[model samples]
Target: MIPANFTYHKASSVQDAIALSQKLGEEAKYMSGGHSLLPMMKLRFATPEHIIDISKIDGLSYIKEEGEILRIGALTTQSEMEYNTLLRRDYPIFMDAIKLTADPSVRNAGTIGGNIAHGDAANDQPALMLAMRATIIAEGTEGQKVIPIDDFFHGFYMTALEPSDVLVEIQLPKKKKGSGGAYHKVERKVGDYATAGVAVHVVLDDSGICQEIGIGLTNVSAAPMRLDRGEAVLKGKKITDDLIAQVGTIASEDSEPTSDLRGSEAYKRSILNTITQRMIRLAIERAQH
Candidate 1:
């Protein structure tokens, strides 16, 4: 399917993109990588009258640590993050999720910004970002604003970003010592969206108690959700068989999954429970080392 007729404008800067979006109003769509928006447009699920191309804008694709936080440019591709030496060593959680996203072709072109900006629950990055406790930086005509990852996602295909705002960077706080994280998913096939996906970030204290933990769920809700109730169950406690079971129960109880081609509601919730436990255990094991 081909997209409907549209005017195209290549933005040379973030400000230019904002200007274009503002001038074009709600009928405009800012495009980067074009993996998410283009497909929807082709299907007529989205029919923007104007395409503001921000892919050509300079300095929007890079990875670097700023102070205690890792700042990722919004245009950084999944493939780039998967292979980034800094991230691969210090934040394997990202690599775990990025490698599982679609296939190589898609990963090569898909931008991290696009993934989160689409606000699709099935997208892998949002869940991982939540687990990492990341933040988003949005630049618009009014200037820049920072939004916590938890508050960034609003609903299905919805986010805090205004139509005229462009997401410029993703900020992730550096994990402390004894920190370990993992991502797991049950998908129908390679490159397919998950039936259920889970990400866990854990930090253990010297006494082997869980000092901090973040559990993120995907495809189990209308938006990528952080399992705060489940995390509360593990925080400050030692990982035990009973405690693990309790966390899994909390995760399953809190998720709001719907029956679809992926699986039945009961089946998805069941998988969520199983994977939640597995990811937590894996994270704890890694943190022990």
Candidate 2:
């Protein structure tokens, strides 16, 4: 299907993008790599009268460390994140998650902001961002504000971004000395979204008790779910097989799966339990040495 006829605008600066979005209102859309929006337009799932291309908005593509935060500009491509040595050394979970999204072509072109702004529950990055407690910066006519990753995605294909807002950057807390992170997925095919997946960040004290835990489950609900019960089961306790088994069950029980081409809700739930446990174990191993 052909997308509805639309006009195009090129934004040379952050202010320009914000102003264009504000002026176009609900009928306008922002384009980065076009991986997320173009497909939707082709499918007629979304139609906009105007597309303001932010791809040439030069300053939005960068990776930098600011004090304790690792700042990633909105236009940073997935491939850049996937191959960034600093990111891999300091935050392996970020790399682990991007490796599971689409293919090399898509990764090379798709922007981190585009993926998060797309808000598809099946998209891998949102779950990872949620687990990492990342902050999203958005600029609008009123100036800039930050939103918690947990509150960013309102629902499937929906977000908290207003028509006038342009997501500017994503900032993640830097990795500490004794932390471990991993992201694991059970995809039907190489580039397919996870049938059930988990992204975990764990910090262990000297006693092997879980000091901090973040579990983000994908394709289990309308939004990425941070499993509190699952984390509660591991806090101040050894990550033994018994603990993993118990927490895995807690994670599974917290999921809200629906049947589709992926599998039945029961099947997805069972797989989520296993994946969650595996990801946490990987995180533990990475943390240990």
**Candidate that would win on lDDT:** 1
Tens-digit per-residue lDDT, 1-289, candidate 1: 8899999999999988998888889999999999989999999999999999998999999999878888999999998988899988888788789878998889999999999999999998888888878899999888998999888999988999999999999998776678899999999988889999999999889988988888889888998899989888888898899999998988889999999998999999999999999998888877777
Q: List the residue pairs that clash in candidate 2.
A: none
State the C-alpha lDDT per candidate: 0.90, 0.87
Best by TM-score: 1
Q: Candidate 2, which ten residues in sequence have the lowest lDDT sum?
A: 172-181
Using Cα atoms with residue i matched to residue i, what is each candidate's TM-score against the true structure?
Answer: 0.97, 0.96
lDDT of 2 by residue, 29-89 (tens): 9999999899889998888999999988988888889898989999999999888888878
Runs off by more than 4 Å, candidate 2: none
lDDT of 1: 0.90
| lDDT measured at residue 259 in model 2 versus the true structure, 0 to 100 | 90
